[model samples]
Target: MAYEVLVQSVVDYAIYLLDREGRVSSWNPGAERIKGYSPGEILGKHFSRFYTEEDRHADVPEAALGPSLGGDIQFETAVP
Candidate 1:
């Protein structure tokens, strides 16, 4: 389907889905570029792996998700 092809071809932003528990459920090429993780390496892993240890330790990662899912949070990071 065209939708599937479009999703597969995306390379700008890391397009992915996470379960309520924050585990990575899917990944695309953009995810590889943004996160330095291959789909094979990241699938089924906790999305928190992208966070710094201090953030994870403070539970900030989990807190951020609440706002993000509610459209109350917007993240802007420089990738380079």
Candidate 2:
């Protein structure tokens, strides 16, 4: 099986790659569909853009990055 091709073509799951400092380094088509952002628009941006204002104020983005950076973490959330 061609795993890379299968993952890249997924439309039902958003895939993101964040840098050490938590900026978006990669974006996928499914992420575009779910988050309303194109790869060009979101890449190089902070992943915090996906969170609510109150969450940002609470440092939720930084907190969330810890687990993902330490190891693979799968999560799902709906963004308005």
Candidate 3:
């Protein structure tokens, strides 16, 4: 499908979707490359994995999702 094409072809941006509970629902090739997680390994996992340990300890994941409940959040970061 065309949706699949655009999402999967991205290479510089980590493109993916999260469920209501912040679990990865869909993953793209760029997400795999940038975050080091293949869909098989990361799907259904919490987005907390992308946070630093200190951030996790600070409950940053939950806080980060609060403002974006009904919208999109965009920021640029280098992931590896």
Candidate 4:
């Protein structure tokens, strides 16, 4: 629970929750900062909004979620 709260307080990385149906069930300050959307503006919206228009239209957002939820996705960050 405390971890959840800490994540909620973040202002980076666009943290969010997607239900089984792939709908956004929650939004956090980080989401607002990275996505330019406030919680009130984006809650209940599909998590695909973070993708480019072409990606969304091609369902690439769904594809990304699949591996992520399956624990087969890995993210690497490099600092320049």
In terms of lDDT, the poorest run of 10 residues in model 3 is: 71-80
- Candidate that would win on TM-score: 3
lDDT of 2 by residue, 1-80 (tens): 58667767988889878999999987777989988899889999999989988778877778778786785444454455
lDDT of 1 by residue, 59-79 (tens): 666776886577465444322
Off by over 4 Å in 2: 1-3, 69-80
Q: Estimate each model's TM-score.
A: 0.76, 0.77, 0.81, 0.70
- Writing each residue's lDDT as its tens digit, candidate 4 over 35-61 gives 788878887888777676776677667
Model 1's lDDT to the true fold?
0.79
How many residue pairs clash in all the candidates, one count each? 0, 0, 0, 0
lDDT scores of the candidates, listed in order: 0.79, 0.82, 0.84, 0.74
Model 4 lDDT, residue 59, Cα: 66
**Candidate 1 — worst ten consecutive residues by lDDT sum?**
71-80
Order of all candidates by TM-score, from best down to worst? 3, 2, 1, 4
Task: Report the alpha-carbon TM-score of model 2 versus the true structure.
Answer: 0.77
Task: Point out where model 3 deviates above 4 Å.
Answer: 70-80
The TM-score obtained by model 4 is 0.70
Clashing pairs in 4: none
- Between prediction 1 and prediction 4, the one with superior TM-score is 1
Q: List where candidate 4 sits over 4 angstroms from the true fold.
A: 68-80
